[model samples]
Target: MVRPRLTIYVCQESQHGRDPQHEHEDGDSSTGTFFVYHAVYLEELTAAELTEKLAQLFRVPAQQIQQIYKQGPTGIHVLVSDEMIQNFQDESCFVLDTMKAESNDSYHIILK
Candidate 1:
């Protein structure tokens, strides 16, 4: 059977403090710097959904999938099969850093 394709975009909060503009003028200090990751993408799935997808895609146990998320935001983790890595590597995937964006449609989309 043909498997459904998955692509993931990961971003982690920076260890450094929040940006001065986001804290002073915006009056939002809770948000810190977030860095987008370019590699190791997964199919955009939620907690429960991803668990199931990982099981079906990789034929692994539930505990393994849970462990991936527990890895924390410091690094990106994906529980995918060995065969999928090569196949999906060429696809275009991205993680948008929209914290500083003002409007919903402000971001640009480029199709290649």
Candidate 2:
């Protein structure tokens, strides 16, 4: 089956941990509408492990998160909704907390 492409436009204020959804009227998922959270970042964690962690943290089934980057010791992005993103940012939950990790290997979650 065909699916919609979700290329996130990382908001500049993503690191601030604030309310940041700017959906457009067209109801587009990736463009001028909808604050769908796609890529999530977690510091000091490998993409593979981070993916697993996200599934557990969100109580999701499995294989929900996917590794987008091949290199660089950065955070992992967990696929989620705009609402979930808000929660993550507000609570600095599993994904947002990664940005504060002391290890450089850690990752910071981002929407893709």
Candidate 3:
């Protein structure tokens, strides 16, 4: 299935606080529901490249995959579609930062 880019919406939000250009469609924000994340790029791979890769492997729209970068080598927070989750048996398998990412750097992957 070819994932069209038109359906993909990439907007920058201030992780916190209020901004007019946050692009988030939440006008009724009487409550808080946003959480910041820590990220890394040990492999130092671009999120755009990884996103396309995962989209193809997971058989979903590439734009659907979301990644958040932090001040780390390879500890980025990734959020992908449920459909993508079904196809996580690929060569890339990412683990949590709490765990040691030693010699296993080769297996490091992105999960948003």
Candidate 4:
């Protein structure tokens, strides 16, 4: 069976001391500094595991990840925690839909 693939656009900016909530409140658009990644997986992953994968891909520390957001029809949806990712998968069928549609929709990973 072919593994499911996800395309993510990870923001290169470090959150550091910035407020994660307010990062996008001012309506700032994408900086075009993202490191695009195509992640293929056969099994569902926890947020920490996802973070570890991203850290390896980006060569950054996992702890530097402050949050992860998925772009949705309504708005950006947060998936920074295990519970949140699980709830998102359950409610929105994110992984299934991505697998079916082969959508290249970006998942934003905010670094600290």
Per-candidate local distance difference test: 0.39, 0.37, 0.38, 0.44
Per-residue lDDT over 7-105 for candidate 4, one digit per residue giving the tens place of the 0 to 100 score = 333333322444445455422334422122244341354776666776676666666655565655665454466664454332122221111113333
Would you list the clashing residue pairs of candidate 4? none
Candidate number with the higher TM-score (1 or 4): 4
lDDT of 3: 0.38
C-alpha positional error of residue 89 in candidate 4 after TM-score superposition, expressed in Å: 7.8
> Pick by lDDT: which candidate is best?
4
RMSD of each: 14.9, 14.3, 12.8, 13.6
Writing each residue's lDDT as its tens digit, candidate 2 over 26-106 gives 244343333323353444334454456555555654443332222123644544543343333321311122232354434
Show the lowest summed lDDT stretch of 10 residues, model 3: 4-13
Please list all clashing residue pairs in model 1, or write none if there are none: 7-42, 8-41, 8-42
Candidate 1 residue 51 C-alpha distance from true site, Å: 20
TM-score of structure candidate 1:
0.25
Give the Cα RMSD of candidate 1. Answer: 14.9
Sort by lDDT, top down from the best = 4, 1, 3, 2
- Model 1, 1-112: lDDT tens per residue? 5443555444333445866665544133566544534333344334455445434544555544332222215544443334434344444443322221244322221111
Model 1 ranges with Cα > 4 A deviation: 1-11, 20-30, 36-78, 89-112
lDDT of 4: 0.44
